[model samples]
Target: MRPFIASPSNARRTRSREGFMTFSPRKTPTTSQAPQGSPMLEWTGERYLPWIKDAAIAYEHLHRYVLAARLAEGKRVLDLASGEGYGANILAAAALSVVGLEIDDAAVQHARKKYKRENLEFVTGSVTSIPLREEHSFDLAVCFEAIEHVEDREKLVSEAKRMLKPDGLLVVSTPNKDVYRHESAGENPFHVRELDFEEFRSLLRQFFKNTGFLGQRIYANSTVWQIGNAHDARIDEFVIARDTAEFEFATNDRRVPLYFIGLASDAALGKFPGSVLIDCSNELLRQIQEALAWRERQSADRAETIASLEKAVAWRQTQLEDSLEAIASLRRVAGELETGNADLTARLRDATHQLGLIHASRGWQLILRLRRIRNKLKALVTFRVPG
Candidate 1:
């Protein structure tokens, strides 16, 4: 694929920077393996990193979901930042043809060797300057976890728009910086800027007719890390200017949230009542708030029930210990009695038997109490009381 000459001067200037470069190291292609193109892939050595495997899997699953919903069979697909070719390979299983481009040579080689499907191909290129020449060539484009690495994000969005068919769909995901603070202290050396929800939305609004952000994926809570991963990661999908009317009304009505799903088309503009978008946005926000409130109440009830159970357990344990001590005292008294003191021994044995029954009853009682408390908590948390 030939690289587009959209910004040759900018690329040259970036290459000539003399200061301590903050940008990640770019990969150099082998002498014999380099493609005969102006935009030689700058290897970032990211493919050799072990974390990329998990990242690739996550990207693949997400892309499959988006494509299945948006694209029909035999649609042309492009996998932007298609690291190690895993995403493209997955997409190739459903799409007519899939083209994947990456900046890492090792990744390109790995993908080429492992995934040799006939409908799939891989190239080395950058998102800011895609190698393809045809405008409106692709029906769908998937760019995941790539915007943070680029210096000029606006240009990247423009490039994506230029390459898409008028009504083509673009699915992009980025980390929610507001929800997740980079634990690495911003020293990754690869990422330029991490964006929160609003920043990302603003960037996309400049090019695409419609943009919608989806909330993060949820996972089990971790005690080791205090923060709950609630709506932490986000994906933003954009559409070109085919039906701009729908999006224009939505934007004007201020119905879209920082994270949402939206539909847009140029033909949709001025056709629908603007108030419809407002109502939809309001309804969505209300639902989200209600869900969050419900979750909080459930968590609180659980905590209270756990605390009560612990207290009951402690009390039962103390009672059992006291009964044991009493039984031990009776045995000592029987032992001190004369050898022929059958009455004293009999009394001690009876006392011990009674204590055992008490212990058993107490254990059952504690169990029942805990069960009742749990049931009550569950009911209280989940029950919708009638007005």
Candidate 2:
């Protein structure tokens, strides 16, 4: 977990997983109960491990505790920069006593309220300049992932060495510089400094007599996730090695290792426990697969609905087009009828004018008079013959 107490400046405080540690593939018993933003530290889904939405993120964030738990057994542990105290609480299960030191006041108060065992205690302090007065008292001092946040690396390392007994073990970790630098989209704005493996080793060598590093790489099942870290293609074998630093390098950068853990002591660390913890969020993975299936079903239903709407729209458009064609045909017929009526009216007016002209002629009047006289003479002749 990230802790800001060791950072170069006070502004570098967004450090994640630096100050915290918790046992169980899930989380510690205490911090899980309290909701984020209550008396306990806020359970930011993206930042904190216990209340994280994705199980894979939670696993990757908290698995360091599993690796460190083996070494801190039955020892008085000083968890530096213990932001939320869960890491210290987890170690408390195995350690004789755990003093969780944090600089952030809210986190310290939150931790005190959430995880209060007789063996577990929370204190407000910085890792670079540890506030603990008791020097050379602790059996083991553990700083999981807080070293890189601080500006003064040497001071933090020296402080950790100071807290531990003459033969106490100092377990510390940092993001591998080569992988973290390139693998990250860009430099983290929250991080003041990030170290490569060589730089990290070089830094640790100054304070600790013998520093043995153990790499923590997360691998996902093929069926489960297409995103996140996958096994290296060049990985031909998986065998137990006596040394903690021994790891088979992946051929490509696609499967770059996530973080590195170092076990520092005066003498050589011989024959560590062969057990390696896998941060494969199988439970969360199953849930995600189910959710994906549900989403696909929803998408198919939406597509069907959209197709039906488009078909209806096409049918309506066709009907409107046919109506428009029929209206145009009716308009043409109406135009032809109007033209025929206009021609007929013009012909009738012309005929009327010709008849009027004939009636007005002088020859026509003379013919009428002649016809009347002839009829009268014919009537007189017929009457005399009859007598």
Candidate 3:
């Protein structure tokens, strides 16, 4: 899995998780070897980091190792460009001795600490110029997902050839350029030189004469067998017609391969049956369940929002009713004040009329005359006493 950092759209991202591929070896160190909550390395979109938990990438990467392990039993093995060294660890389980050659020093140290076995060793070295002293030492050499990453492709292939014995086999895999370049997410950024099917075959043929090719792709499949026994299996494919919805049987899977695996050796190349890795973890089923749970959560959130809005509207309606009642009370008070003002005006008129009638009857005039006579008498007395 070469790193092609991509920001897929919503639809594409969903599709990526729905499909599944993986190998389940009895003692494979793909995931369990790493410390809890700590992976050896972070996934850079280029190399397969064991703890990534991606079903598709796991199948694409580890299934190739499964094929290699089948051929590696009791043989000296060389794992070139072993990123996290999990593949080397898997090969080590079956081989007499295994050496994991890597370009990054940090990765070598991490692999050495993470995956430990007496037969397994980790060393820092480039694929183009391997650091081992012995020539033609390894019986089997496995390089995967590393060819497209190097500047010197030929030197890398030659180094693998130079390290392998005369009858040794080198199993390598590369992405099909046709499909890889036009992937839905985007082209891989880390790949320097991707090859088409023929180009890859020709490149391997330059080093070894006998070569075998295999096309690899991910597809959803159903498997059933006898409960207590194993038997031969045949593959059948069903596909829908392009023009219509009619179903038909495909004689062969001729679709463009997403990846290709090449088998090369000076001796006659060994043949193996077509291989597929099933995810025993049921990762696809889990993804579907998670999607359904997400939808339920979304629906519950929408319901809660609607209920909050309804409560706000009800509160506003209650406030409007209270305002209307207050306005009616103010109107009643204003009516009472207007009626009291009219009665007061009528009483004041009545008092003014009564005072006028009393003045006309002469009582008020007689009182004023008496007050004037008193004032004149007081003046006469004062004038008589002044001589």
Number of the top-ranking candidate, with TM-score as the measure = 3
List the candidates ranked by lDDT, beginning with the highest: 3, 2, 1
Candidate 2 per-residue lDDT over residues 65-172, each given as its tens digit? 766666778889899877667778888888888998887778888888878799998888778778789999888888866766677778888999998898888888
lDDT of 3: 0.79
Predictions in order: lDDT: 0.58, 0.70, 0.79
Q: Candidate 1: deviation at residue 154, Å?
A: 0.9
- RMSD in order of candidates: 30.3, 12.0, 9.9
TM-score of 3: 0.67
Indicate the residue-level lDDT of 301 in model 2.
97
Candidate 2 versus the native: TM-score?
0.62
TM-scores vs. true structure, each candidate? 0.45, 0.62, 0.67
Residue range 247-289, candidate 3, lDDT tens digits: 5555465456888989999999655778667687888668668
Model 2: residues >4 Å from true position, as ranges?
A: 1-38, 45-47, 177-189, 220-256, 278-281, 305-309, 312-387
Best by lDDT: 3
lDDT of 2 at 168: 83
lDDT of 3 at 378: 93
Clashes of 2: 14
